[model samples]
Target: MSTKTPTEDDILRPIKNTTSKWFVLFGIAGLAFGLFLIGWAYQLMYGLEVTGLSDWGSGGGVTWGLYIGAFIWWVGIAHGGIILSAAVRLLGMERYMPVARMAELLTIGGLSAAGFYIIVHMGRPDRMVTSVLGHYHITVHNSPLVWDVTVITAYFVLTATYLGLTLRYDISRMREDLPSHFSPVYSALTYGYTEEEDEVIERMVWWVAAAIIIMAPLLLHGGVIPWLFALLPTYPAWFGGIQGPVFLSIALTSAISGVIIISAAFTRAYNWDHIITEDVFRGLLLWLGFFCLMFVWFQLQRIITGSFFAGISGTYATQAMLSSVIYVGALAAVMAVLIFIFAQALRPSLFTKTRALVAAVFVLGATLFEKTFFVVEGFQTVEFSIYEGVPGPYFPSLIEMSSVLGTIGMVTIIFLLVSKVVPVVELHAVEHLQEGHEPEQEAPQEVEA
Candidate 1:
């Protein structure tokens, strides 16, 4: 018997269905993004003085504030999103195949948001770009910022290419059934496609996934990002070898939380519960718990190491960690509860999707707060001799806060628009499910002569 294939209509339902709710969400996101543009224009006109960032010596404030913190957070989300998708592919975790496309989209959206933060952070983005382009060699080797730019750009290209290549298979398979408006895009995606090309593209994507898995944990978040903080000897709280692992753990935690949030939203809005499934949520929740455990472990290590010393920097670092006790405690408590709930989920009747979703939201908020506190508090407590009696008042300005909201809005808009263009759920995965459900045909009996 032949197995039934998933129809293009099924995959394109999200695009075809134009509900009032979609309009409401899109309108809100567009409005917020417009506000973000306005905020940037205001900054351009008034200069960096409108924000709280300042030169430590001249103004007695932190140069990197909410923007840098947000940068780190968005970068982590991007790295984590790709890692999740790669893990599902590389590890043969077919159960997660349904969510892989969503994760990849998250990576793209997250990176876009992160890049926007970098532009916003640079008070004079044009000058920064001109200088970098003009004197490329001067800073490429010596500057960690240049290294970050290099890695982020490379990763973005690699990811986008991976997504584009993979879409060829889906687009070609669904060519006849796709909407007329999508024909141009489908043609571009499936140009020069053949049955033989699928294998080649699959192999290429596998290698790309492999590259991302290695580069993300080792080079991006684990190496360059942490080094930005750890290499600075002046910032005692950030100066440590363990910073890499800590950041990695936090990245995974936040990424998983983000996935959970998106998945929950899609399930609720589109009634995609049948496709997304409960197992996916449970699996993601368990992984989220594991990373949260790692986060707590790393925090303990930092606290112990810092509090062990009597030096001013060490003492101040300890104080900073202690000062954010509520966030840490909340994170730890949520992790523990999730661990228990995940265990209970394995056996029987106690598993509720809402509980896991609630836990994920809590973890996301707690992690963001903890990270922002880490950045701001590190600067708040100064140990340098020259800046001894200076008052360091660093709070996010109205513009900075608006920019944050705007970036979030931008991410939402990106996801919404992209979903209209492509199937958020992988078509192959849907086909696989159909195959599993196909009825088996028995062999025919021999005819009597």
Candidate 2:
């Protein structure tokens, strides 16, 4: 049986086909983003008090709250998504090429959300800019927060450049089919484009991927973000050698889950099931399951180390973990589902796309809950020098919750708008589909070795 090859027209369907459903979706996202801006304005006028965050030594309240938790979550997603995209390209994982551009888009959206949260969390956005710019030379070397800003900014630039370079290739190919309104943007993006430039652009992208692979694990997610928490010895839960790996694992799991959700949505909306095939879903699921398993292992390591005849801080960390029955149960349930899905994969008749998608949803939810719990609970176990009292339970205020919703809305809006402008699916992926390449049957022995 011959598979249908996707033509340039098919690749450019999103640009050519402007449907009511797209308008409705874009409208909803725009509305949510508008509401978010309003909520942010309200926050600015009111102050940080509008949210659940409280300063240390002030009525025995925790400093960081939902915003910081969300900051970490978004940053992790950005880091992991870009890492996956880079890794797939670097490792020659053609099986995932269909979803590579989508993953790259996730990196952009996630980083944008993360940057927005940093501003929102400050409550004084102007001050944040002034302070960073004024003290960059003085604090860049000494401050973890500054270091985080540096790496995140660098990562964002790298990912964006990688995406832009790749887009130039795609846009040049589809320049004729693209809408008239996009002519200016296309010309700007593809300025001085020629057929000979393709190889040069490919080499540039490969080097960028190589740099990202090095920086992501060594400097960004695995270094600065985790160090923000781990370096603080006062918070026993956050401070440890394992914090980096644990955080990286969560990032990967959440990022993979995010890609699965996005791919499924695109498949449903665009009816590109043939291009975004079951093989793509299966590869992502396998990676997600592996990360979820690693997450459980890291949690066990954390629990055992903290609970074995531990001190006040260690005991506090262990107790915090034990007390969160909901978190533990959610993690366990997701793990079990992933395991079952893997089992079903062995027997093709038992496997279903919906099952994998559902598991991805579960992992996404579980990771969010777990990260929030980590942030809140780390603050709860406060090591005070003078004042001594139980810290109050930190419940996010209406404003804080609104901001969360708003940020998510903002991400959706950005993605929807970007999709309208550019092909969500990569041009090379369409060509790959046209070539009718079969999925690899087995791993190479050298790769296995």
Backbone clash count for every predicted candidate, in the order shown: 0, 0
Q: TM-score, each model? A: 0.92, 0.93
Error of 1 at 319 (Å): 1.7
Model 2, span 119-162: residue lDDT tens: 78777888666868788998897876677678778888999899
Task: Please provide, for model 1 over 327-349, each residue's C-alpha lDDT reduced to its tens digit, 9 standing for 90 to 100.
Answer: 56655665676676557657646
**Candidate 1: residue pairs that collide:** none
Off by over 4 Å in 1: 1-8, 55-58, 325-348, 440-449
Model 2 weakest 10-residue run by lDDT: 52-61
- RMSD after CA superposition, every candidate: 3.3, 5.5
- Lowest lDDT sum, 10 consecutive residues, model 1, at 1-10
Best by lDDT: 2
